[model samples]
Target chain A: MVAAHALTVDDMREVRAAAQGGRFFALFDPNALIAAIARSGDRAAFAELFDHFAPRVKGLLMRGGASAELAEEIAQETLLAVWRKAALFDPTRASASTWIATIARNLRIDIARRETRSRLSQVYEILDEEPPEQPDATLSGAERDARVRAAMTQLSADQYRVVELAFLEGFSHQDVASRLAIPLGTVKSRLRLALSHLRGRLEDLR
Target chain B: MSAVHRPSDETLAAFVAGQLDEGLALVVACHVEADPASRQRLRDLQAVQGALLDAADPVAMASGPRDVRAAGQGSRSPASAPSAPEAGMPQVLRPYGLGPWRSIGIKVAMRRVVVPDAEARVFMLRAGPGIALPHHKHSGLEWATILSGAYEHEYGRYAAGDFDEADSSHVHTPRVDPVEGCTCIVAMTGNVLFQGWLGRLLQPLVRL
Candidate 1:
């Protein structure tokens, strides 16, 4: 089983490096971890997941412009959601990281919508829609995850940066262009090319 | 479904990022429900999100409440309502109450969908075969998903399960398919500004 206590930032880096070094298989098994929580309500499994994911979720929220306090709060909520929804996690659909990241992203969005609802109430209504159904079971979660990582590495620096800003930072095309000191049309074309490339690379899995 | 209209990459990115307003997201959800390809695309986008999260620099947070067992047991049930399948209503939309269909123009009917705490207006529009909507531009973003039948605009043909995203720059008159009438769910962030002499004359009468 993975370690059960909270990990410091340095410890997380070592874990991440190990994951990159192909040592992850021996140290952690996400499917087994989730199964433990699902089958026996194992607090150790929950702790392992929380220790690994909570800090990463907070970092992601902070990158998306959330305050530190807000990020921590959302990260806590995300892990709680993981515990509550452990039974629903199907290893066939998505990897553990992908599944937990989605919960964190959705919770952050919910908080943002609640904050903006009143100010934009006359112009737009917040739609608190449910999450999409289980992903198509075409490719194994590990295979898809590896392919995506490979495809991302193949992208040109500019293309990658545009995607990172747009997806990770939630910046609009215009905003990305302004931030990168590039023309708006260039930003659009680069993003378009990047998406097409990623799609072309990942389409075979379907 | 493969040939059906899809939202642009920018819109898809925004949707995945949770930046889209509720009304637009609803229409996109309906499209996703009907298209497996879109669902796959969503998964790919989500994988990118996962990678970014993994590589993100962690910041130390002061410990607040660390009791997962206590917090996890309190009120974390999925807010799923009983399935109430309705014709032309996507499963994601069954929770909201819809108003009565009112005549908006010739052979066109519309019904408002109540979405709380939303600034964008959500509604459903049904147009008869060969019916042409007035040419107009939008003040902000306008998103629509065809529920049944099809429509042809200046851009391209949009069939059932297709999504159409219109901004202030778009100005076109969409005509329902000649063989079958078309029905679409739409969420608009702002009012539609009618164009031309006839459109100006009828603008005050048309609310959408």
Candidate 2:
């Protein structure tokens, strides 16, 4: 089981480096992983890829209020999507997170629609024009990097990890509980507290 | 920067994970354009998510677990990409004057667009004065974003760019502006639950 904690900024950089290291089998980069999955049906590459992402998918689902079981199911489904659609993984358009997020978002929409049985509703209505307005004071990519890093620094190690697991990796409350060998209620409580704390701290950056 | 209101954290979380319907998403887009605070929250959420992704440990696959890799690596024909252009307001769904508003129990002009390969569709509505839609629940997930005018549902009044999401369980009728007409965009997936005879009759017209 993966450690139930968020890595410090330096640690995160290391993991990113490992993901991009390409030294494990061949060239480092997401492209290599895509190539490996394409050229050789590389289980290792896919595993590496899964290791990096499944949690994030889980995080997204969990934050959206899916139960732990649902988050796990979604994570597995998302990984399967990554596997089946590996060839479609283009580095352009978005990074891996954006691409995966798109798939996750679509999948969630599908599940939500399926459950609701709303076939009569339209999908995305086209607007006449792209609104000229832009997001207000969007953090520069670099500033975003800095602020997030700074935010992460404020979290206690345990709280940070829980936040990471719940938000980034999509670990369901149950999953986190089990992984940490804690009670499910404890997991939920921790998550609630951690999110509350993070929300308070991140607000300062705004 | 923009006049749009940001979505609630719960909705933003859903959007970040791709859970939002298109109409709801459009409203969120409008809000993101209008509200910097919500935009920053979304960005922060995304950034934190990125950090967590980088930190996750790789799970070990069973030995000889190659079958799972087949879909990504092996020769497989791509699914047909949807023919419709990417999501933005399109003129195709525009209707001159109001057609009969079906489920919502109002007289409204309606236009629609279906995504090519994706499991989503979009609808635009222009409800006439004092019109109200039928009271119906959803068959699948549904999203409504007010583009112009305003309407009231169980959740209260929604003005242009206000978003509401409904699932199979929700039921409401958006009463058009008591005086002014209401224009809105809706994104729907799966089927719709038509509540009354009018809804049943108009059900056929409401297709994704």
Candidate 3:
């Protein structure tokens, strides 16, 4: 039973090798749990989701520089949001981790809004939540998730770091630049190149 | 109809990454709303973010599962439709109150969009047919989304549903469409310094 996670390049290589030549990866089913909660307001399902994600969400926040208290507050808030906004989840479009992480990221942006004065408040803009239906709707969430994982492994190390900082870490380009010790234009170009590449690869799914 | 112009990919990536501030995000969202292509583009970028999240290291929540579940009491009733604001504003803007339109220049009317805690001041601006906005430059970044009609500047033409952005370094005059005029939702930091002596003399009169 291969767990459905790859935290480093070596792991990603192994995952990709397994994924190549059409092997099966029996992953945990967070989507079904979210769907169950959405359908029946299932407390059991919510508890399971909490057990699985609360810590990971908190960890993600802490990596981006949130305090333990702040990360805990937001993690709790994020899980509670999972309970409240479960109905909005579209299993066909995103995995449970993606949907829940998007929520946590939005809540973090809300914190950023409260502290600093910037243009970031656009949460719950349905455009932020409702993915326009994909060109092809038949793709399973896990299949798409795996395809994305494959694409990540394809990116050059420099390219991948930019994507990771901008997306996973939710760092502003300026923050990414300073953290990577690269020029702002370099950050922008790398991200632009990375996204264009990712988009091109994912477009095959559509 | 779809927009011919959209926010830059870097901006859209930032928008997808949850880095764009509320005002700029709203502007890009309007374009995303109006353009299917942009919407798909954002989805593709977000897919990568989601995959990265799956690999993110776990930082244990201080509280146990049961305690974290207790954060919100009982059921939150479903949200109702927001109060109606001015028509022609994006559906997302319905919750925010729109100030009355006040004329700032010949055939120009502007109104504030009260985005709670938004540091960037935003406004809905209308320019009459064939009218050119005063030549000006910004002290900070400015993002505008055309709601209806069209406008043009040295950069290019932005029609209904289009998004345009300019920063301190950009200085040019923009004109309302010749026949239809234009109304755009704009967000910006700092002030607009109207260019030229005539613009300076009238700056006090044209503060938006």
Predicted structure 3, TM vs. truth: 0.82
- The model with the greater TM-score, 1 or 2, is 1
Write one digit per residue (lDDT tens) for candidate 1, span A1-206.
23532443335447777679574633556566677677777777677777777888888788767888989999888888887778877665677887777777767766666664322211111122333344355676566777888899999999988888887545777888889999999999999999889889998655
DockQ for the candidates, in order: 0.33, 0.17, 0.37
Off by over 4 Å in 2: A1-136, A149-199, B1-6, B19-38, B58-106, B116-122, B134-141, B166-173, B178-180, B188-192, B196-198
Q: In candidate 2 chain A, where is summed lDDT lowest over 10 consecutive residues?
A: A119-128
Chain B TM-score by candidate, in order shown: 0.84, 0.62, 0.83
Candidate 2, residues A90-171: lDDT per residue as tens digits?
Answer: 4432345544655564455555557553321222111112221243534444355456667677777777756655543234
Best-first order by lDDT: 1, 3, 2
Quantify all predictions' global Cα lDDT against the true fold.
0.72, 0.54, 0.71
lDDT of 2 at B122: 56
Which lDDT tens digits does candidate 1 get at residues B72-111? 5323344343346577577767656688887767787777
Model 1 alpha-carbon drift over 4 Å, by segment: A1-26, A115-137, B1-3, B72-78, B82-85, B117-119, B190-208
Model 2 chain B: ten consecutive residues of lowest lDDT? B89-98
